[model samples]
Target: MRLFLVSQLLLVFISVLALTRAQTAPPTTTDTATTETSTAQPTPTDTATTTQAIAIATTTAWTAPPIFYPFGSAAGDTEQFENGGDTYRDVAFSTPFMFFGRMYNNTYVNNNGLLTFNQPLPEAHPYPFPTHGSEDFIAPLWTELDDIGIGRYSYQQYTNGSVLTRASQEINQYFPHKGFSASWVFVATWDYVQTSDVNVLNLHSAPAITFQVVLISGGGYSFILMNYGDCAATYYPVEAGYDTISSTDYHVIHYAFDGSYIPNLKNTSNVNVPGRWAFLVNNGTETENVIGVQLKLSSFLDLTLNENIEDVLQKIKQELVNRGASSFFEMKLRNVETDKEKNVAGRETFELITLT
Candidate 1:
């Protein structure tokens, strides 16, 4: 009986030892698997972090906004010549009038009435006169035409109230060897009366005649003219008033003229007959004058004028200034015509405006 009891105890002790060994062996395998899993997870996480960092570093920077410079006025002071005054003329004669560094007069008029070839007006006879009627008629003068280096030449004549002929001349020799191209405005300030006779005659004319820049050659020549008449007869003759004209690309050349005549020509003699015109080389710049806001520049890209374009231009100008552009590169403003007629009962103002 004692031997049997001892055997049972020995068997129980062996079973306990086997159970302990089995439980401890599983723990060892589990620990190894946990370590492997942790290590594998970190590799993918690290790779993802590295990729995210690279993408952030490669992002592009933002572009700055554009800017705008004004060409006209915003407020009051009736007599002042500054932009905002009531009587202030929004006419721009020449702004930044530069071509290859030298400043050339952009306002030119080629009427045969005002100048005798090569002869600038005597200081006394500044105003233009008719070419034919008066024996005293002076040949029209041109300061720069003889010196123009390149371009074709042409001439037209008006006779008996009609266009008589057009002629072309190969006068390259007459032009200057090298000169910067420019634009100009032509103005005619006159008082016309409906004569009892069939033919129209000038009752009392204050004709301010000038010539324009006509391109004979090269890709960038444009001529423009604007005439603003003060009396009713003058305005009615041309059907001139508020009007807007456009061109293809801003760089494309275009020519236009505007004129207006006031009623009761005698009463408004003091009121000036103002004209506005411009010539742009290489690129055409657009300007707008609003009553309340600063002047705006239109985009040259599409050459389409829009209400908000001015705002965008202003932003662009600000950005360019921030980017270190000089004030000379900044846009300029000008008033071309300001002189008032002295002889007329009512003041008649005439100007040749240009905006560079």
Candidate 2:
């Protein structure tokens, strides 16, 4: 009886140890996989999210960078240079001063330095109208406005305003006093909402139709509407006397009409317009014919200063834009100004001095 009782206790101990091992030991691979498949399996939505993330990463990858456009000349000396990073070409110039720079206006930047186009290019920003090396360094942004004067210029902050209906705007655009403004009024067939500010060359459109407008701040400009679709807006002619100067406000209006009235109002079958104010008047409603307008500051300068850098180690970070080149570059340095006065230089000063 004693031996049987001892055997029974041993059997119970072995069974209890087996049960504890089974509960505490790691699960087999097949068992773990079965549990994960039901709870942690990747869904279709998760797979699609991963795929789109990779596509965005691939498309936005930066191009081979650190591009350099190096230029300079020491007053009447012939100078030649080459870009070590990019351009895949050499530049040579025999002139007094070579135009090169990115920013820091009025101060000479470098006699031997490079202008970097992509200082970490952003995904979106104001792009230059004419890219560099286009037209042999001739800035394309001023292609239409170049006939007025060749200069380094951009739209000023003081000149920011929307076109008010029936309200005449007299904008004193940039320094040296160039460009034109108008008091304009219009009636649209659809409910009109002039929400976007009419920047000089930015495209503005209505949701109803495919037509667009640009209020380029030049004396004479041509706007080509990238029109498409099943809908097109038709423009009418101005009244016989709408182009006359307003007697009360002394505001002048000019119209280039279809030749039932004015002998010169014939369409030349070309898209280019002469730098004069005109209206496409049809049947007499000003709004029906005035699809667009041209404000005029028609002057001409032959050349512009581009760079004013004085330090070799200093490089202003700027996005490479085809904003195009200007014949005259005007700059202002707030650092050179005092609270009471501005220590600006004259626009007519240039140099050809030898450092030796």
Candidate 3:
């Protein structure tokens, strides 16, 4: 009877120990997974909560504020340079500006309302953009502008925190989805600049053109903002836009090509804000037009009808393809006559071709 009693106690103790171990030990992988799946199943309340979170995130969209910057003596900032007629001042950039694919560490700020890289364009007169010109330039009112006597022009560059923040915010508002942050900004203002023709023609009165060109760059991206303020009508040919070397990329502002409609620039805008135009110019794949590509080809290739014409056509086709042109597009050569010797300074006079 004692032996049987001892055996029963031992069995009871072993069972108790097993129960304790089972209670204290970590669960097996399969058991843990089963428990999680059972409890973690989505309820209607969880679905509603997730949907609400997504809605809240989507509702918080960002919008850019006003597009204006301070300038002149009253603004108590900016570096003023000597003003002249048809002359340009070589200004070194605090940071290099990447344009198209070229990097420029300096620029020639011309008095006639333009910024030219590679060389200075001191001509008092203005020409239409996509001139197929060799020099790459940015014109905010490229005319015979004179700030020598009556007007003031100044520039300021920013690497400061506040200005960088403002630049980032303004660019984000204009070109969204890039999540851009501006590391450098250069602001050039042509305040109350008068037309050079006024003095030459001896006019009793002339209109004053006020505008600003702001360069914002960061993270291999570059942008330009042309801001107009109270641009009055002028009798000079004013071209407002930018052109790349070989005319690969160019944009001409509406009404700016004709001199008579100069005042319209003050109220017109590309971003819905009056007197403002913004453009992304560093990698200009998005801004380049089909016409620009044709011009680019004209600048390089001698599109003469020769025995190797087939090879020339194939070369042109391949060039277009290399530049992201669709294979299904149509191209037509217009006015390829031999008498059309309008090619001057690498600018072909005859319309080489049109791409559609």
Candidate 4:
């Protein structure tokens, strides 16, 4: 009877163990949704070969937008450029298939091709976003779009009262030099979060006049923009920045805005309001939209694209002492090496505003 009892007990224990396992086991999912979520993120792609830099500074005046639409059925069709530009197609592609590099596919080269900026923004933007190199800009804390280089976000917009056309407090271009104009675009996006008395967007902060500049390869970038700064930054000159992405990359930029043109304006004007500027070191993500801040641009009569990105970086280092951070600045260079190469992007210039 004891042996029989022992065998029965053993069987009971095995049964209980099997029941527990079954209860705790995870269910096998065969649905497509489950499969997609399980492996949604893409692995990092190999670094691309360093591209040759292009110089856009022609002596002739640029009557047309830097990019030309390759194909179209009408003259008024609307399209967004790769580098965050919304446009109203003024004239169709009249120039010989000219091109410029922009946030991935700034132009709709595909028109019907199915392979441009073809990924979701989350997957397309750079990961580990370069929030680490805040010190370079001189600000202990960095704001949005600080070092964002050019990507394929800009497109053509052909509307009358869209965000690209309306809401510009000022869309003044500068003739920093005789032969060239500070040709940059400044668009107003949504408001950003801030806690300053400066009253951005009449009250809110950040996302002030989203802007961008072009690189050596003709890609648009955001190097300078408006911001909601700290106590010290809110007053006098204002809190602004120029990150390493634009400072280090690119050949030349025509920072469209200039506060000095209007004397005695720092106390009231947005141009003079931005005083302290900083540069954030590259975070090493080659392909991502960047953030930006406001800056005081210097009057450059003949700024040209730099031949070497390193030289441009070194010049910026020197300017920290020469120009200092007192509002008022200027930069002219082109080309950014990809993470595959340390290069990247813009201008009032919002090049990369990546606040998602």
Tens digits of per-residue lDDT for model 3, 65-128: 2455766555555544434545567889989998877899999877778898888886756776
The ten-residue window of minimal lDDT in model 4 covers: 347-356
For model 4, state the Cα shift of residue 75 in Å. Answer: 24
Provide the clash count, candidate 4: 72
Off by over 4 Å in 1: 26-31, 38-41, 44-356
Q: For residues 204-230, could you state the per-residue lDDT of candidate 1 as single tens digits?
A: 122221222221112233222222223
Per-residue lDDT tens digits of candidate 4, residues 287-320? 5433343333232221233344334334553454
Give the alpha carbon lDDT tens digit for every residue of 1-356 in model 2.
99999999999999999999999999899999999888895789999999999987655622111110111121122222211111111222111111221111111111111111223211122122222222111111111111111111111111223432111222222112333333222110101112232221122232111111112222221111111111112132211111111111011111222213222322111113211222121111112121122212111221132323211001110100012111122222212212212213322222221110
TM, every model = 0.21, 0.21, 0.57, 0.23
Best by lDDT: 3
Give the distance in Å from residue 352's predicted Cα in candidate 3 to where it truly belongs.
Answer: 17
Q: Which stretches of candidate 4 lie over 4 Å from their true place?
A: 1-175, 179-188, 193-356
For candidate 1, the 10 contiguous residues with the lowest summed lDDT are 63-72
Total clashing pairs for each candidate: 44, 38, 0, 72
